[model samples]
Structures are given as C-alpha cells and as structure tokens.
Target: MHELAIADSIVQIADRHANGRRVTKVQLKVGHLRQVVPSALAFSFELVAQGTSVEGAELEMEEVPVTGSCRGCGVESRLKEFPLQCRACGSDDLRVLEGEELFVESLEMEEV
Candidate 1:
C-alpha cells in the first residue's frame, strides 16, 4: 500500500527532527480530499517503524472536513465526495476553502 511509503516518509522526517530522541507520537492533519485510509496508514506506520527510533510511536490523525464555497449561491458548505458540487446550489462552480492537505502537525518526543 502507498500508506507504507507515506509512513516511511514520515518516519524519515521525524527521525531527522528527533535526533536520537525517542518518538512517542506523531500528529497529522489529513484532509478528506487526501483520500488516505487512516487505519491502513497506522498499520503501515507500525510495520515500517519496527526496530526504529520511532518503534511503538503512536500515529494520530486529525481529519479535516471538506468545505467549499459556491459562486452561484454564495453559500459555503460541506462537500460530498467526488463530483465536487456545491451542496447548497448543486453548482460545479465551487472553490475549496479547506481540505486537500496532508501534513505533520506535531511530534511528541522524549526530553533527551
């Protein structure tokens, strides 16, 4: 699964920042549009981090809901998956105000 690669990447970045410190947890802000399966990502994280500095590190994910603004109705609302139409007016002319992100928010680390 691609989540394995993604988890590996996260471990690499965390390892660089941890600098010999043990990682306790990693927080990620994931958007709905990112389409990442949280369970798969967590499983992959545990598998890839085995015997590493981050072994047993917890993977915490915060889901960001899809919010979009429709030009036709001037209304902002949650977006349904795919087709990306506005919920208020059913218009395709929608601009996303949030969602579509995948980034590390924080890393819990031991103090030396």
Candidate 2:
C-alpha cells in the first residue's frame, strides 16, 4: 500500500526536524478522502523509522471528515460519500472544502 511510501516521507520529515535528536512523537492530519489506513500507516512508520531519528516515535493521526459546499443553495455540509451531493440542498453542484489532505502537523523531540 501507499502507506509505506507515506510513512517513509513522514520519517524523512521527522528526521530532518529532529536534527540528530530523538523523535518522541509525530502528529499528522489525514483526511477521509485520502483513504489512508491509520493502522497500516502506523505499522509502516515503525518499519521505515528503524535506525532513524524517528525510531520508536509515536504516530498520532487526526482524521478529518469530508466537507462540501453546495453551489446551488450556498449550503455547507459534511459529506459521507463521493460524487458528493450537498446534504442540505441535495444539489449535485458542489465544491469540496475539506478532506483529501495528508500532512505532518507537529513533532515532539528530545535532545540527544
């Protein structure tokens, strides 16, 4: 799965920020639309972080729900599925306001 690559990238980021220090934690913001498996990502992180500054670091994932705004009724609502129709107006004309995100939010580190 892509989680391995994603985990590698996270390790790289944490390692860079750690600057030879030990990483204690890494927090990430992941959106529902991204379809990332949190458990898989955590397992991959452990594997990828071996021998790196981020080794043994706890990975904290915050899941973001999908949100959309309707162009027809100017209503915003949370979306549960794709081909998203606005929940309030049931309009097919919509713009996504959130979801489809994957990023590192913060890092906790210890001095060497």
Candidate 3:
C-alpha cells in the first residue's frame, strides 16, 4: 500500500526535525478527499519506524472534511458527493477550498 511510502516519508521528516532526539508523537492532518485510511497509515508507520527514533512513537491523525464554495450563490458548504455542485444554488461552478491535504501538523520529541 502507498501508506507504507507515506509512513516512511513521515519518519524521515520526523527524524530530521527531531535532531537526534527520540520522537514521542507525530500529529498529522489528512483530508477526506485524500481517501487515506488512518488505521492503515498507523500500521504502516509502526512497520516503517522499526529500529528508528520514531519506533513506538504515537501517530495521531486528524481527519478534515471536504468543503467548497459556490461561485453562483457565494455560499460555502460541505461536499458529500462528486460532480461538485452548489447546495444552495445548484450551480456546477464551484471552487474547492479544502479537503485535499496531507501533512504533518506537529511532532513531539523527547529530550536527549
């Protein structure tokens, strides 16, 4: 699964930021549109972190919902389906504001 690669990348980033310190936790934000399985990511993190500073570190994920703004109605709403249409004006002209993000929010490190 691609989660393995994602997890590996996270570990690398954490390692760089940790500066040789032990990592205690890694907090991440995952958007709904990314369709990443949190459980799979956590599992992959454990596997990829073996023998590293990130090993046994807590992996916390915050899920973000898809949201969009309608140009016709000038209204912002949560999106539930594809073909992104405005809920208020039923206009196909919409701009996606969020829900395609995958990034590390913060990291906790132990003192050396």
The whole-model lDDT of each prediction reads 0.88, 0.91, 0.89
Give one digit per residue, the lDDT tens place, for model 3 in 1-112. 8889889999999988988889999999988788888889999999989889888999999988889898888999898667678889889888889998889999999977
Candidate 3 lDDT score at position 110:
94
Encode model 2's per-residue lDDT on 19-40: one tens digit a residue. Answer: 9999999999998888898899
lDDT of 2 at 25: 95
Score every model by TM-score: 0.88, 0.91, 0.88
Clashing pairs for predicted structure model 3, backbone only: none
**Model 3: residue 96 alpha-carbon error in angstroms:** 1.2
Clashing pairs in 1: none
Which runs in model 3 stand beyond 4 Å of their true positions?
A: 80-83
Candidate 2's C-alpha runs over 4 A off are 81-83
For model 1, residues 2-97, the per-residue Cα lDDT tens digits are 788889998888878888989999999988888888999999999888878888999999999888899999899886478788877789898889
- In model 1, the Cα lDDT at residue 75 comes to 90
**Superior by lDDT: candidate 1 or candidate 2:** 2
Q: Which 10 consecutive positions of candidate 1 have the poorest summed lDDT?
A: 79-88
